[model samples]
Target: MLDIFLMGLLMAQYTYTGYDASAHVAEETKNASTAAPKGIVMSVVISIIGGWILLYSITAAIQDGSEAGLTTLNATATGLPPAQVFLDALNNPTMAKFLLFIVCGAQFFCGMASVTANSRMSYAFSRDDAIPGSKHWKKVNPRTGTPTNSIWLCIVLSSILTVPALFNETAYLAVTSVAVIGLYIAYVAPVLLRRLKGDKFKPGPWHLGRWSAVIGWIAVVWVIFICILFVLPPTLPITISTFNYSPIAVLAVLVLSIVLWYARGKKHFMQHLDKEQLATDEKKLLDEIDD
Candidate 1:
């Protein structure tokens, strides 16, 4: 039982890693073209290995639990054969601290992966003149073939917000949960717009069509459910009191994301001015300033 819970926790962590690899390499590939093929293969390999690792860990945990003469699992591990085992190690201060570091580490990497992926998306969107800061983010470093500045910009911002994790376990989980939801919400746009709306926006040259929509909607719902569950006070509490204000934090993050989307993106929509118009606008601005 302990093993099963441990395994689940470990797998949750492995989930966060592979995505970042693809993002960090975004610029190196033939004008932003290479990561998809490499990313797909990379994901496949890691996912298969990651799954096997979790399976092995759970099997070992079961063996350990049986040796301890535990007919059933303890209260704290995650996967059951033990219903909810998030805190089996809490009784042991050292183990609790270790697990805290592990959870924080995995979630941190997961968030980092998100930062990578998002910067690529933001950079790509900007390249199309569809988002703010498009020119700078999409600019490749002359030598590295990386969106160097954008990568650092995102990493820095993500790290700062991640600071909240130092406060309490609940805060850590809540904010990450919110970030997770934001990821899927951004994904849903391409899905729902194509599938439900049929807005004549065909898939891009390198696009996933009908199937993507199905997967996207399913994933969105799945993630939403998990995000909600994550913030909910655990049905079983490991400590003296359950946590609070998790949903509130989630709301704040959501609001911030929305504000950012509009503050940065609103002007770009349907407002693509040709070079001449832009030059004229710039000249006018300069004249007004001089006046």
Candidate 2:
């Protein structure tokens, strides 16, 4: 059960995936410093409550393990299967179909929202010249105020990434595993860097205040732990079919990124704003005034 436990963790993360949606739309949001952070927290809180409730109901519906007997012909379930659980719980195919439709719709919306968020993030990063071919991806449509190129790029990349899922049954798990690991690293890196900066770090309007260091360290540590846990083989006696490709995918991306950084990014990539530079300039101005 390490595999089972890690899968549960993955489910928990997937349940809370859209917390950054507000951040993506912060430019259009009013009082973003206050609102954006609130959005993130509420999203997580709601997801936890809702996910727990759903899990409870599903467990409750599995009243008799004997009634949901295992099928020797099937490869998926050695014991009671989820499809049997749903059917037995609902006691009606019509109700099950309706529930399935609702779930499908929700998944569709979630996918759309993710695309929106990723595209916006790509556009913002590109605008700061952090991404390759930033000039093209950074362009915002004058009429729509949207990054069309970045949006299309996100779509294309998502499609390319999911292509393996069409051929391999376990490919979707690997894709999601890679996404979760990469995202957690992205989330933790800034937090760890902020922790290293210590008291000299400036706080935004919405910060942890006195708890910043504690919370930052906790966040960084937890993310690193989970990232390692998820990258391990999802099942024992790893075969080509059961093997997790997430670590490979992540390593490939890192290698490609390092190569690109040395070849072109080192010279071309630029950060639009440097808080350290701003602080230094302010100090210089004060010294000039005193002199």
TM-score of each: 0.57, 0.85
Q: Model 1, stretches more than 4 Å misplaced?
A: 1-27, 31-38, 41-45, 58-63, 66-115, 122-140, 143-145, 198-201, 204-217, 235-241, 244-246, 261-264, 268-291
Report the lDDT tens digits of candidate 2 across residue range 79-145: 3255556777788878867777787898899889999999999998787787788999999889898
lDDT by residue for model 1 (49-140), tens: 97688656645545345544454454334433422232352346566456657867976876666666767766667665665567677687
Pairs clashing within candidate 1: 3-61, 76-84, 76-85, 76-86, 77-85
Candidate 2 collision pairs:
none
User: In order, what lDDT does every prediction score?
Assistant: 0.59, 0.79
What C-alpha lDDT, on a 0 to 100 scale, does residue 107 get in candidate 1?
65
The alpha-carbon lDDT assigned to residue 2 of candidate 1 equals 50
Candidate 2 stretches greater than 4 Å from native: 1-3, 66-83, 271-291
lDDT value, candidate 1, whole model: 0.59
Q: TM-score for model 1?
A: 0.57
